[model samples]
Target: MPAPQMMGIYPSDSISEVAHSLPIDPLGPGAADLLAGDVEYRLHLILQEAKKFMIHGKRATLLPEDVEYAMEALNVEPVLVPPRPLPIPSFQPVSVSSTSSSSHQAQQVYHTPDDEIDFAAYLKQPLPAGIASSAGVKWKAHWLAVEGVQPAIPENPAPGTSRAGPSRPQPASTSLRPQARAQLPQELQLYFTRLTTALVPPTPSAPETEPERHRLAALVSLRTDVAVAGILIYVIKWLSESIQKCLMAPTGTIGQLVDAVDAVLENEGLFVEPYMHQLLPPLLSIILTVPLGPHPPSSSSSSQPSPYDVRQRAAEVLGKIAEQYGKSYPGLIPRLVSTLTKALQSPPFPSPLGAAHPPAGRYEGAVLGLAALGSQAVKSGVWGKAGEGLSKIDELAGRLYIDGGKRKNPLIRATIKALSPLITAKPADVQAPQINMNEVTNAFGPYIANGLVKKGWTANELLRLRKEEMEEGEGGGEGMDMDTPRI
Candidate 1:
């Protein structure tokens, strides 16, 4: 056995290197007389050290440990240094080394990686005799906890300098080290143990909402997530088409729609519902016309691509599906309305009516959403108050697309068409169906009437449609553009 190295040999040697005798100078005392034999042996010890200190052509003699080594070599007997001729190398070797001593030495040499973790425990006590467990600990992979903004590891932790960066495990150190454990208060030890135990075993991870996001930049990279998003959109839209084609999709499909929507909304932080409300009218405009034949009029097909048979279809369909299942989708329409209302209603900056809030692209969206509900109603033959829905949207977004310069917007004309009967003087015998017209008429009625007025239609025609609206002054009903659900 080579035997365990004693602490006395290393750090004790270092401390003794300095003279107990007061130094005559700040640089300190020089070495006293030592025998030639001692100098030779000391040179031998220097050779034993690993070739770690070489710089240029010279080895440094500056370490405190070097001084102690020199002193020890000096103490050897005079005869040992007496010069003699060197012998040739021998091939003979000892048979075997003792297993017990070898194993112990291995244990002493091979520390668990966790022993190298960040803090130097020896500094908290007495300074360590030698380099404390190889500079630092491996960052135990187990130490990773819930993610949040982590503070920087300061070169100098004291206030002032710009933060270096948040500390993260060096790539080499990213591994689990079972031996590493944090000391905890007795009161909290079990809690910590439980936490560490829970963390160390790889907890089941929720599926990657976006692994593709890592490779692709948010704005640029053609989203791999786009495939996923597209699939979801396809599924939802197909479900929608199936319903529109089959007259009301199965309730289970509705569940799948919800799950898909929630998964998307949660992941993207986008509300597909309102966007659908915004997107669908345009899509259904096509879908509605899909029934209208092979030589479908250029008027129906021109200006935009159809929203069906593709994933881009999803964006439009998302809004409609949300409208399809009211109340089941909270934070859907109201939130959308709030955002879109702010945008459309916002004046240009440095103008009247509050700081020009950003536009939400909702004016057309609201009209589209209400119209989608109308399509569903019309398809199901459920007129309920969809007629009234058209009216309500009229009060809020004032025939902007229809009369606000762009007489060319197809959606504007579509809105007028759907509610044409309600807006024009309907014969009393044209019975109102007991379906939801609130989403339709309230959302579009006024706009239809106003379009008539702007087109120079008679007042009799305005009076012809049921004016559920509260007239401006007398306010018999809700005033112009009240967004409250007429349902």
Candidate 2:
């Protein structure tokens, strides 16, 4: 069996592509009314459904068409359209001086104000809430639109209403208000009853209306992929927004906005767009310093973040960004050093008269980022910054070994590593402690004279040496070194 004929075939992962349509309404009562979001949830559903489809030797690619089929199978409302045609105006002109104008005009021309959108009610909608938080569900509608499954069409909708057609909220069977009952004309009742029945989605007829049945005899695939696709889409969008701000903003607005990048950085998601680690520090630096006006603390009670916390958080995000997409980032050394130094300061001194503030973090990563830059720059053909980069190693070493508590641990080892690449480093010459006279004389003066005599030095030379030693010994011998080896 020649390899089971698995030739010239390829599979594509479309989770990121159809990710825009990740939100779907899962089954249950009142699900229609509940806002449907949770794209991550939807993706899991799609994966499960896709797995079943795979066993039958189907194409692995989850195309938009496949997603559409999956949505239908799952009984999800991925698309909505205008339920009825709009009241078209025939363009008939009317005279302003018509006889029955005042009361009649008010009745005809005035429109009711939109019922205030119940933000609470909207948020309570299951799907919308999740989309807002994680971001994938909101884009699902667009995904469907792109796939030719149009948006919900509205009937004769209220004026000033956003007419994403046909998707009007029919009063739920469980509306808050009590139902009013009255006898209606038989024809009207029949028409309404039929419409309601059509509107009410029944449990999907499985293994028949579903695509799986067309291909296989007994397999029934239930794929509710909308949620995950939507979530991924939302995240993509969120990342898009983040990337735009990170890359395009004149200066970052990390802390300036009410809902800023702090949420994203602190949140639990990494595979974001333009995912460069170097961007993180710079991004945060922009936030902390830039923007036209300083972002005052939220309240007196809100404590300012310690320099260490802020710097660490930024560093952590950068580390992950680098780990995930370091390939895309250029100028990592300069960018990292630039940002880390910013982290170590409270912004630059504005002027001679500017108000002073405390120092930023001890510039913890400056040494590391610059050190890494020294070697990395050489490899990347960015050797121009190497000279300046080597300076960081010396600076860090000086701080560690001479200034900052004279630490002698991993920090010193790291300093050494950082300094190893520099051509300018020399072993530091520290002054020796005071020495005993006995040690000095025994090691240098008389011992040298004795050794010289034993080596057959003339008596004249010995007498000269003894007289010189006596003269040198008269003083404190601060600069004496009469024990020069002669033999």
lDDT of each: 0.36, 0.37
Candidate 1 lDDT tens digits, 1-487: 3334342223433333443446653332222222223445555565454223333227654564544444455563333443777864544433444478546332223222323544566345644556546677333322222375334444223434445753311111212224322332343334333322222122212224342232123222112244333233333343344333321222222222333333444444333543455334333332322221112224533422332222123334545455554577665655544443343334323312222332212334333434344354321221224234444444444433324442334434444544443344545676533333333234346445445433333333333333443243346244433745653
Please give each candidate's TM-score: 0.24, 0.24
- How many times do residue backbones clash in model 1? 51
Q: Which lDDT tens digits does candidate 2 get at residues 1-487?
A: 2222222212112333343466743334422222133444576687666555554457766555665566777887676567898866454343343356454442223333445898778766677555567844452222234365445545333435566543422212311112211344444344333322222223222335643233222111101112222233233333334433432221112221212233333334333454333335454452233221122323421343333333344444555444444456555545655654444332333322242432222334443343444544222221123133223332433433323332333323333344445323333573333334343234333222222232222223323343555666665353444433431
Shift of residue 282 alpha carbon in model 1, Å: 16
What is the C-alpha RMSD, rounded to one decimal, of candidate 2? 27.9
Model 1 lDDT, full chain set:
0.36
TM-score of predicted structure 2:
0.24
Worst 10 residues of 2 by lDDT: 216-225
Task: List clash counts for every candidate, in order.
Answer: 51, 39
